[model samples]
Target: MTTIEAPRSRPTRRRGVNWEKWGWLYMRFSGILLVVLIFGHLLVNLFLGDGVSAIDFAFVAGKLADPFWIVWDTLLLWLALIHGANGMRTLTNDYARGKLRVVLLVLLAGATVVLLVLGTLVLTTFDPCIGDSTVDALIEACAAQ
Candidate 1:
């Protein structure tokens, strides 16, 4: 039987950034950060206070109103999407060939960018005070603004 060879590092462009290395590093670092952010989010939203029953539009509105939560959510959105996209790209590279790989990579990148833009817009521009909601929670939240 032939011995399997180890993976080799590809040659890089002179004076250019080694993006593959950076991507690998990002995967590791972002994974650790995501665990913390995700767990914290779950604990606050699902376990504390009234638990799962407490989640609703009003609860979401309240969280989004705070700048801290807005930033927290933005980070979660960007990091998670990019991390997932990067992994997909890596998988596409490893498993796909020729035109299919190119097509998949392009599609993956386009989708990731679109989602990131939309998610960020929603998070940053969300107005809980909009619309006519009779819920006391929403009404009270709007009134305080």
Candidate 2:
């Protein structure tokens, strides 16, 4: 009779930090938050008051002028961008190979950072009455100030 042997398994090592675990948690939490934020945003922009027609420059300016809206917008922007970028990173890891994967990840990170910074700046420093004398509404709004 021939002797039978069992395959040996490699030993597993415990790491100090579990980044993948944290990333998985982040995806779950961020997805939940994004759903609420996005729905609230759409409801406010498309269902409240005058609806879509009310969504013009002054409307945006008015919203951004409020501290509450500013914070809300910033949170939405950061969360959405990071969530999207992380998702893309996961996809890249799964399908991309070698240098191309690295390049795509680096570019993704760079773009996310740039967009977050620019978006935050626009939200925080927006002036409804900047250099525009054509719009009577803006002129009136600025004149009141």
Candidate 3:
């Protein structure tokens, strides 16, 4: 029986920046923040005041009208989308192979970008009074503005 030879290895060297380490840290921190944001969102929308029944267009308009909620929603959108895209990239790297892996990663990036742009636009440019509606309350509110 011949003896097995040990595989040769290159010496490890320090690099400029370790992005993977930072990504791992980001995942942990963002997950914690997402939990809090999600819970607070649910609490306010589904459990407060008139509960889920109060979740009409007016409700959304009211929430988005506040600068605090605008910033909160923007943070939620960016963090969650980036976190999800990074996770998918990791998964693709782990399980995918050949050109399919590249395709998947590209698709993931495109989708994430598109969603982030759309979500941010919606959050920032939301006008509750853009359309004519039969709702007197909304009409009056818009007229008052």
Candidate lDDT values, in order: 0.90, 0.87, 0.90
| Native-structure RMSD, model 3 | 4.6
What lDDT does model 1 reach?
A: 0.90
Error of 1 at 46 (Å): 2.6
What ranking of all candidate models by TM-score puts the best one first? 3, 2, 1
Q: Write the per-residue lDDT of candidate 3 for residues 68-137, one digit (tens) a residue.
A: 9999999999988999899999999999999999999999989999999999999988898898756788
lDDT of 1 by residue, 39-137 (tens): 989999999999999998888988997999999999999889999999999899899999999999999999999999999999989988888876887
1-145: candidate 2 lDDT, tens digit per residue: 5555566755455778888788889889999998999899999999999899889777887787788888888889998999898899999999999899999999999999999999999887877778766668779878999
Estimated TM-score for each candidate: 0.83, 0.83, 0.84
TM-score of model 1 relative to the true fold?
0.83
Enumerate residue pairs that collide in model 3.
none
Error of 3 at 67 (Å): 1.1
Give model 1 RMSD, 1 decimal: 4.1
Residue 81 displacement in candidate 1 (angstroms):
0.8
- What clash pairs does model 2 have? none
